[model samples]
Target: MCGFIGFLSNTNINSENKNNLTNMSSIINHRGPDECGEYIDDNIILCFRRLSIIALDSGKQPFSYDNNNYKLIFNGEIYNYIELREQIIKDKNITFSTDAEGEVILAYYKHYGKSFVSKLRGMFSFVIWDKINNKIIGARDPFGIKPFYYSESSRGLYFGSELKSFTKNKEIYKKEINSKSLHDYLTFQFVPEHNTMFENIKLLKPGHILEKKINQKTKFEAYWTCKFDPILKPQAEKIKDIKKALEESVKLHMRSDVPVGCFLSGGIDSTIITALSAKINPNIKTFTIGFKDEGYSEIELAKKTAENLGVENINITISPEEYMEAVPKVIWHLDGPVADPSVIPIYYICKEARKHVTVMLSGEGSDELFGGYNIYREPNSLKLFKHLPTPLCKILKYISTIFPEGMKGKSFLERGTTPIEKRYLGNAKIFKDHEKKPYLKSYNKNYTYDLVTKPLYDKCKNYNDVTKMQYIDINTWLKGDILVKSDRMSMANSLELRVPFLDKEVFKVASTLTLDEKINEKTTKYLLRESFKDILPEDTVSRKKLGYPVPIRKWLKKEMYDWALNIIKNSKADEYINKEKVIELLNKHKNGKIDYSRKLWVLITFIIWYEKFIEEV
Candidate 1:
């Protein structure tokens, strides 16, 4: 709904700092073009841009409370604000001046202190300057649906909704590539944990809160974490609970003053969201995007789903040329490299949806929360290994190495023998440790994917393999890749994208699902499909998850071959990457020797991002 940038310092405010803040705000103006506001003082400055979702005229922020003693700048929607507002009025006996959620947040903070964040139920990243206490309190939503980035330097601490906002004020924060993040990005297709591609700047982990007293070091604490506690209940009862939770979440998420729409796909997740939304507003519109490529496009299926729900479907088919042309702009908006090919379609879809509506509901967190990924079925497929002795499995793993590359059953043996902690690294595994040594000029052997996953694995050691995998994704994949593209792509067009599936209420129901309920021998998200079987079309409910498929593999083989080769040739990343190795992979792909699309895409995305932020800057 909005974007904000600001800083806290011990030095007095100057005209140059004010100018820097203005420039920072201008860079992200697309996030909120409706209005802008600022709050400045001797040691702190807050600048905000508004899209005016809930309160239209009343929600202009830098909303203050308690005789202007506490000032707040927020970037997201508090779907439960109306309910929280009533609670605050009754508890504190305070009269509110505006309908803005930010004011309610301030009043809540005044009454309950930092503990107030726990009571909030929405996607948000906010900073509250407690002028009275002379300290600042900042928190990111539990699921990280909204972004918050910060850096510490001699000039002080700077924080904002996007990484680019900090680039404008170079004197306050210098830009340099973080080698560790780059190395890990090669493996995960995203920079994991708190570190970003840029040095000093770090993403505030979801469910975490930050507190900083003037001139004191910032302190962080986890306010919440995603953990699964499966309750053994009857299948019918669990299905009913899931249905109730999702409907309630959809209802809460639909609260907005502006028109709201839903993103539709042939897949069950989006189709379910659109189906539920259409029931609430019969005139609801749905948006979909696909490619001209034969197998890559889901337009027809989405159209059928939309027609079944009796809603108008707005769809677009992107060409190779259109996708190629949008690459630079997409990477720029992402603020860093995210090699997920799906980002392209999301960008185009958000651009198309913004033409008709200011707010759109999406189904992003469903896969992670409800175990919708195909890979979640891996443990079931590899059940044979569970029956084998550990020593025998080790022997099989050794024998697997003897088989040639691309040999049938070679990967199966290797994966079955390995422990889940070592084998599974969320959904995207672009490069292996040894593979990176050949591609990365400055590869650190210690900078393996385990550096990111091990700590997460340790936390959920008691969980089942399926739950552990979900936990890893809920922390790494969901926040790093999925939610990053969701926030950046939607904000790129000034459209407010809400994810009802990621709601705390919906997650509570998902967390209680048993492994058999989430996945079985035949399908994933078993309970989810069962709950919506009657409401959705049969094919829509039973369809396998294709995700937002892009024709990157096919495109790399033909239309975009030369374009990709040219980027590799002219890239300024030679100091960090092995150009010859990357070129070899590209050439091999073009010759149809192998499908290196994902690896090439990861490298190409980093190159484009490097040129934009490093060279151009």
Candidate 2:
């Protein structure tokens, strides 16, 4: 619901540092244009920008508690604050001065110490400065629905909700690209771990707590882990539990003081969210976006669902030119490169929804949480690997290399022979290990995507293939890509986007679903469909997942060919990227020799980001 930036310094604060803090906070004003608050002490500064979701008049932050001994600057919603407040008042006999959620957080921290985070639920990233103990405690939400970035410099530690905020105070921090992260970005289209595109700055992993005291080493630890534990239960009973949990989550998520709306799409995830939300509030508004290109737009399907639910549907059809124009701004808001074409539609939809509603509910975590991706079905198709001997599969993999690239069944053979740990790298696989050698000038043969995935895969070794993939995504893809775009795009428009599907209660239900309940031979999210069949339209229950189908592949070939080529020719990333090779790929796509849209887009976004953050700065 907001954005925050601050620093914990090793020395006393000065006027220069105060000015820098103001500038740093000013840069992210779009995140919270409603109000601004600041708290400064000898060694720490906390600046907050409010979006005014719940406690409109009384929620101004840098909330001081315990006789002004503790200071808290928070950047998310505590959906259960009302319940927590009641418990605190009864147990400690406390009198609150305001209805702000930040007060509830401070009281809980006083009572529970470091363990307070586990007792709460909702998406959040916050920092609390204990003036009494000269200590700092920071934590990100369980699913990373919000962002928290920090850097440890000689001056001190600087933290913020967006990476761009650090750029405003160059005196305290230096801007240098992290080469290892860039190398990984080429393969995964994102920095898969805690390390970010910048060298010193790092993203705090989800469900993790960071503690730092003055004149001591900073420590980080995980307070929660997303592990799946399926229980043996009847299908009908499980379905009933799922419906109840999701309904409760949605109802809680709609606890905004302002008008709340839902993002609708042709897919079932958004439809189900809208359907459930409409039942709670009959006059809810839904937003959708699509393209003019055939087989890409879902406007009609979304409209049909909205009509069926008796809600007003506001929609737009983006032209290729409009989509191209928004690319640079989208990349800037993202704070780094994310090659997901779906981000464009999300950006536009958030902009549109903000016009009517201050808070929007999205369906981002459903795919990762409930095994909704089509690739999850790959394990079932590759069952032959389990039947055949390892040596024979290796031989088949070798034989597959003899066939030409893109030959029928070639990728299947290659993947079937390879281990799941090596073959699967979350949802987006832009450049493979061998493919990056030609495109990256600083490519290290030893550095590969495995550096990020191997440890995660090792943790889930006991899981089935389908469950392993889900675990990997819930750890990497869900946080790195899906939530990044959702947070940045929504905040860029000053809109508070909430995910009912990513709630703690809903995740507990999803973790217990069997593979048969999640995916069958014919469809994904099987249990979800079965649970909501009577409420949703039949086509919606059975519709395949086509999440924001962007026609970037077609645009790169025709409409945006010259625009993309211009960026490739003039890009200043030659020290890191091989421009000639990228141009060749772009030429091949335009000439219809290959469909290199996804790969080309990855390079284009990074180039634009480089220009914005590196060259322009």
Candidate 3:
């Protein structure tokens, strides 16, 4: 519910250097407009902008603990602070504190070191300055629900809730594309962990902690991770445990002192959240975003779901024109390039919700936890198709390329015949390996798809088919694409977005279930629905997961085609990308030779971001 920026230096500087930190924090003022505070000590400068969600009057930062030996600036809600505080008081004899999560975090760190992150349950990205050790310890939430970006420069180590905060540092030059991150961003919609467009800047991996030793080395370590732990419990026991855990998550997520709302998307995930939320408090307010197009709008469905649950539903309708208009502003808030078109609607929805509430609950991590995406259903088909001889498949892939681009079934044949290592580049595969070869400044065939999927693949080496897919998503799609967009979109509007589905307790319970319960040849999220079969309406339980459908494809073909073509043509990215090749792709897309919506959007987003953050430099 707040945004904070902090710095640790090897030496002190003048007013001009101090103003850099001030400017960095000011850019994200919308994230915490209620209050602003700064802390400038011997070798550190900590700044905070507070949104005042919980302990409004008392929760201020940079809050110090152990009599100012350790100071902290945190940007998130610690749902279990009340429990943590009580445990600390009883077990550790800690005393004298307001009921704020920030204070508990400081005390916990004072006692636990980096181990404290594993004990907390909430969405957070925080920095604690240990004056005693002269070190900065940082941690991000387990599910990547919160964002933390850091860059090391001659000035010092600067960290913030968003990348824009580091823009004011004169020493931090806008370096060229980090190729590894570029590959991931093109293959997926967003860049994966430890990779940012700028060479030195990086995203803190989820479930990981970074320890920067004074005037020396910085080390990153993973403190927690979710694993598929299949239990032998009976169905009845599973249902009871699921209900209990989910109810607890919903209740904890609503621990704010101010008004909170839920994003009801007319899907099983949102319905489950709304159903549980209303059961706790029927006055729970919910918001849903719908489009003018019937193909994308889920307003009616969300309204019915809300009505059935006896919760108030506030629906916001966005027109195509309006959605396009919000693109630049949304892109700016995103900080880096992210091509998820839904971010536009999310921005408007959060903007509207902020008018009524300071915090909003969203169903973000459900798909990754449970098997919800349609792609998970393709493994069997892919496995069968993988039987073809490599040489024969390569021949077929080459021939398929000659078939008119975007022709029906061409993509399937191309993907099916190609090897998984070469064809399946995470979920949002935009450009082909060959297509990127000519575009990248320096293409490295040495870099393979294993770069991103290897970690999860190795982790799930002993797991079942479904569990492998789940693990793959958790490491790639979940953190790289979904959580990145979720955090950026919500924070863009200065609204605190909490994902009840991502609660560690809920993850612990869900991860224990086998693949058979989660998904089979018939359907996905079966076990999840059955657990709440009695609570959710019949229609809700049986409904298929229709993703937040955006009209980007339709817009690219008509309304936005000219604007997009112009961007592609004029992009200074020609220095990195092939201008002629890009123009050809645009023309083919305009001529209906290719259904290049996703690819075009990714390219345009990257170009715009590059121009804004890199080219002008």
Candidate 4:
């Protein structure tokens, strides 16, 4: 596990570019503080920072063969390397140079060619240079567990594990903000994966590969697509399969040369992981963080859950000031604006866990994979809208506006009357189009969220409404938001975080579960809860998602109201947003006339991100 940077250029690799490459790699040194390596040539340069997880003695990266005929730079762990290498030795009569995973990747690619990625089962973002073919190829994992960003310039193609790496060479890489992305960011609170907030640099989509040669257009294609063809089966059969798959996944994810532990939140996601992990390795350690008894903190629950599972639990309580102090650095580590307040404690927990362990197991993808979000139940609550005619639905939407704000079914009447895409853009809905009109100077009706979600919705046309929501989120909310912050926060602490819930085999079992199994009248993650009911605490099976709930709304009203007002008053946001309007909203919240805390937080984060990335201040 590490961070890497490389560029393929038509011009010579001069001393200036070499210096920039080294600086870029060093800035992300926290990602892999153990060791470093480099490979420089006339037309290309590959720099790597090593964290030394799997084969600590011989895992130095930029792994090459045939005297540099094929060089590699990778940023994630390949869990199936042992199996792949054994097969290559049997079928291709090839002998590996070391026990490290890179050689297995090289050998498998040599035999399978471009299709090699589809055969692997792990979280990875790897780039290989085929010197003989005069081509360089890069691929991100199926679930985007690792990150890959690149910029196309006249010089050539530059890529790296973090956006800051590309920013190191500003002579070639530009840092202008993408306004449409900012507009979308206000609604979603994070930029979409395919489009970064920066104009030139973009995230390579998960499950896809980009291949390019000198004087050739980059050819990009998806090596795999996670499909949901829910198979109807007995409840008992589905529960058994899910149980078997999760246990197997946890076993595979424990493949590490270093000590491994787990992060335990109050939510069942992490509780389930800790239970399964303790069964396999009873000595495993777990970590948690929370606040005082503010009705939202989860530390007490995490403690009880940890004791029930019989693992050493480390719990930390963060004061409001400590949480406030960590914001700037957290945003810096994040590489972009992510308004998810939960990241603060997540970052701190990873930092604390790093002192005791090198690798930590996390429960990130379970919610998205199993339809665990409470918002997913909207379709069931709004079933009446499906029976209404389209014209009548539109008329009802107009009439619903006349209803008071707290009136029953006001939101239901408004959302139920509209199409899914128009109403739902994943779980977040911060600012509506008309609301954003007061903020931005211009809006592109054509380039609205449909540019992102329509394609995904069209692909899953035959799925049930709940399944369709899960599909959209698995691609957008899961990849763009959840995994992005998860990677950045964990890596920021120089700790390797693995998600067994995101394993390919686990996803297969989850995909086979019908909507009823995922969410029913009583609870979310119904099948998952049933599968672990015998193992986990009975109350845990029905617990709501109380993981890391920071009191942002209260903070804005009391603790940070003055600080927030000054930020807006002093911000360059006036160029894009109406300061008077923003001030009005902030005042309304402070005076208890409204609850625009989320919108305010999103705006403040954007300002902070813009200043850090674009303004160079």
C-alpha lDDT score of every prediction, in listed order:
0.91, 0.90, 0.81, 0.85
Backbone clash numbers for all candidates listed: 0, 0, 0, 0
Clashing pairs in 4: none
Please state the error at residue 480 of candidate 4 in Å: 1.3
Error of 4 at 154 (Å): 2.1
TM-score of 3: 0.94
lDDT (C-alpha) at residue 548 in model 4? 70
Candidate achieving higher TM-score, 2 or 3: 2
Candidate 1 per-residue C-alpha lDDT over 469-569 given as tens digits, one digit per residue, 9 for 90 to 100: 99999989999999999999999999999999999989999999999899998889999999999999988877998888998998998999999999989
> Candidate 3: what lDDT?
0.81
- What TM-score, over all chains together, does every model reach? 0.99, 0.99, 0.94, 0.97
Spell out the clash pairs found in candidate 3.
none
- Model 2 per-residue lDDT tens digits across residues 422-496: 889998888888888988888888888888999999999999999999998988888889999999999999999
* Strongest candidate by lDDT: 1
The candidate, 1 or 3, that scores higher on TM-score is: 1
Which stretches of candidate 2 lie above 4 Å from their native place? none
- Name the lDDT of candidate 2: 0.90
**Residue 198 error, candidate 2, Å:** 1.1
**Which 10-residue window of candidate 1 scores lowest in summed lDDT?**
169-178
